[model samples]
Target: MSDTGGLFDGVLAAGPVAESVCDGAWVQAMLDFEAALAWASAAAGVIPEAAAVDIEKRCRAEYYDIAALGAAAVRIGNPAGPLVRELTASVAPEAAAYVHLGATSQDVLDTAAMLVTARALIALRAGLHACADRLAQLAEEHAGTVQAGRSLLQQAPPVTFGLTVAGWLGGVVAALDRIDVLRGERLAVQFGGAVGTLAALGDNGIPVLRGIAFRLGLAEPVLPWHTERSRIAEIAGALGQASGAVAKIARDITLLAQTELGEVFEQGPPGSGGSSTMPHKRNPVAAVLAAGSAAQAPGLVATLLSAAAHEHQRAAGSWHAEWRPLTELLRSTGSAVEWLCIALDRLRVDPARMRANLEASGGLLLAEQVAIGLVAAAQGAVGRQEATDLVAACCLRAGPDDLAELLAADEVIGKYLDRSRIDELLDPTGYLGSTAAFIQRAVQDWRSRSAGYR
Candidate 1:
């Protein structure tokens, strides 16, 4: 890679992603595959246990020059070949002979990829849980806090902010559940030798495959999946779904933090989110990071899907296409979840501003309630459209201190509804129908679901 990744990675990649999927980690995983292969072969009696111990002793990636190995790998077309050559050279000839006995280049590379991914998932799971828990907490805190429900950028009716957060939390919860399933099933060992057959091992392949998988904490497939690429594509898709879920929340928070409609803001120290030209600005830096990282998922995932369509058995250029994109998918998704955890945890909410925005639409926001009140009060004197028109006309002027006084001034509407009923109808808090119930459902469901994982 370059000194830095693409524009987004520098802005959005978190420390965990950098640590988990870096060249060092990759090399370590490859070395781990070598060590496990040696141990498995020895356990199967293909090699002496003493040779296995010797090979394992030398398998630490720290002992090798990764830069030289990486350069040699490019020329050799894969890292395992160059790595095994150096390994055999380092150990006694008898022990070195057992270094990568039954495995091929793809086996080492693919298994290494799994090891890297398994480590990455540990970070991702924690991030997602943290974010979800924060959202659930916020949902409980703001259960009855009223805000304007918007549709197509226009005010529709009253909705609690808690309900809105519940929707976002719901998406994240689904992503977490999907991740729980995929990690268990997809993070398995890849041990197919050259040409997808362990013909060289002669009936010992299955035992060796199972042994190495057990050593690596991975599942062994019943048969070689050299060409079946669903697991790879599924991992990409699942990761994309997770990033996309968090992106929805980031986009919403960014919108909420807009200057004209500042219902909420991210909690940060002084000078955070400051614009160079506009000193008064406090931008949504955390949301920017969350969105920026998530933005890479779809295209990278598409590349993974394309890479899955490789040519016969081992693939020509197609399999090679997967290395970077898959790593990027893992990095971006994990980083997105990490940043969202920060943004959600430190989010500063202004329930007062949310209520003000709800009422900013004037009594027009209560037009639906007014129309419903008119049906009963007017009896046959007014219809729904007439009631709607009357409220619209009255709303052209600013509302009075009380909506009851405002409507009492109306010669036409005063007879239909009185002051007490008007006050009751115009209250946004009373109009939040089932919003709190939904929020409660979300919080309780989250508590229950998160319990199982814990």
Candidate 2:
């Protein structure tokens, strides 16, 4: 049999981050069941008001034997089989028949999964927004906090910690916007019985489906999606892309916090990652977890792509293969978002180290600035190539201290600008064009969009 362990397990092991996704699945399943019952009762006109009230009460208070559920699941080689049995046992005998009327196992399971995905996406958006907020705060706090910008593992030039944080915030904001776009798409449901057509439910099937969706707070689809799994595939793809953003941030943080760099550090207690042999090591464990979880999402997404290839109206094997992997993707992605949020919140930056690193580059970092200044001063007198050559020759020949002294003494260059003005222009803080402003705009936009729901 295929691996059918609960997606909750992977998320729980990571942290409370997966709680929203895990609990949402069970809650969504119950809600779908309620919606189906209510719709069926209204259409049949045989369901009494009192019976509907009792069914609602029982549905909300109902408990399941999870161990038995698991055993049954293994026996039948299906997750919905056990869930259906458990839900059936929870209601009164008279109302039990109407509980899942005209619904196949896929109807309940697929709808429930979509609900879980929606809730998870909401939680992930919140996580990304919170991280963006914190990053903006850090950027503001360290706007003038200059440090060495590295390329190819070598110090290059001066850059502010604020600017780096702003870059991260930009990526996160983009991901959040993508999530908002996806939330509006219709969450397709599987309602067709035995095949793509609703033969089992007779003529009134389409109307019943609309009623069911209305009751469940879902959009109605034109037809059942027994074979059309593109929506699911798309959601998984979006999730993987979001996870990639988190991973990129984690990788950058991990590199920045390296001992040799010493420009930034993780702010949590040092005991998070214990060394088996070495006593002085305090590893960036959260970063490592985020990277690993983010790395796994793409493969899970690929699995979804494979599952989308159904044979005719239904391929039980291919369809079932989607269940566990999709859940795992949700859980892992949720965990990555949570971890990155916390990591960004507690990060510590050292401006002094940044300056030292910049100086270590032997004045090479300011080559571009110097070239620009020369170009401006010469205007039509010097060509771009001559300006670059002059700056490069100056940078290559001068030591860290000698470069500063030489630049200060140069009469032609100093005539157009003083040392103070040059330093200010080259400062990383002055170079951050509109990072904080962009972050504020994103936050406001998100708030306006979410106002109605809140």
lDDT of 1 at 363: 60
lDDT per residue as tens, model 1, 3-76: 64656565667848657988889888988998898899889988899998888888888888988998998886
Q: What C-alpha lDDT does candidate 1 achieve relative to the native structure?
A: 0.84
lDDT of each: 0.84, 0.69
Residue-level lDDT tens digits of model 2 in 60-167: 413655556656777767656766666667667876676665666777677777767777777777777777777767767776677666678776666667667667
The deviation in Å at residue 395 for candidate 1 is 6.4
Q: lDDT of candidate 2? A: 0.69
- Evaluated at residue 54, the lDDT of candidate 1 is 88
Residue pairs of candidate 2 with colliding backbone atoms: 147-354
